[model samples]
Target: MAKHYRGREETPKTAETPRLAVRYYPKAGKLQLLKRWKDREGNYQVGPGVTLDAEDLQLAAEALELIEEFVGSLGRGGRP
Candidate 1:
């Protein structure tokens, strides 16, 4: 059997950016959310942001979408 990283780690949305990272933990049988940010020194940091255990991939995906939209609205000086 081939070892698959997707079952064990977060999937980066892009090679150039870390906008929305997601991972499925086989052990936990749940979907995880990853978030990224930069510090005052301009160094990047990444960490686990959230975990959804309702067993609904669609719900988790929808939540992420709403979050992205809210952030975008905030950037435009609008209500999130």
Candidate 2:
């Protein structure tokens, strides 16, 4: 079985643009994209917002692209 790795890796050295951390819940059949942002205290805050369906491949692809763009905008050591 493939191991699932949650977002627990070390944060990059440089500031990272906001990236969507996607989670696929098989039992729920919904894709959850986490909206991450830094608080005023410079602490990381991740919240769940958009919920999509697995059957919608196009939507999923679009979401992925959007997330990539969001992360890439951060500049170096950002989301991949």
Candidate 3:
């Protein structure tokens, strides 16, 4: 079985919602953004996630920045 290490998690205010986490897989030397939530039995489960490589980091950051700008503009009533 492959071993993975969990890093920081961004948890939701409600328990019913899935939390996002940053995980590392040493064997693959990769970072992933994954969701973790509880099942009906109260056991934690891992859901499908995005694997980000070195090349994708900058692109993802820029995309998120644009999203942030758009969201911010909404409050200011400005065009994004």
> Top TM-score: which candidate number?
3
In model 1, which regions exceed 4 Å deviation?
1-16, 54-80
Report how far off residue 61 is in candidate 3 (Å).
Answer: 8.7
Tell me each candidate's TM-score. 0.37, 0.40, 0.42
Whole-model alpha-carbon lDDT for candidate 1: 0.58
Q: Write the per-residue lDDT of candidate 1 for residues 1-80, one digit (tens) a residue.
A: 22233443543332224555565565545556768777799877767567655345455788767767877898776676
Write the residue-wise lDDT of candidate 3 on 1-80 in tens digits.
23343433432222223576666554454567678887899987876787645444455888667756777888775655
Worst 10 residues of 2 by lDDT: 7-16
Q: Which stretches of candidate 2 lie over 4 Å from their true place?
A: 1-18, 55-80
- Give all candidates' CA lDDT scores: 0.58, 0.58, 0.58
Q: Please write out the lDDT profile of model 2 over residues 1-80, one tens digit for every residue.
A: 22343424432222233665656666535556668788899987777566655456455788677866877887966544
**lDDT score at residue 22, model 2, on the 0-100 scale:** 56
Q: Quick one: ranking by TM-score, best first? A: 3, 2, 1
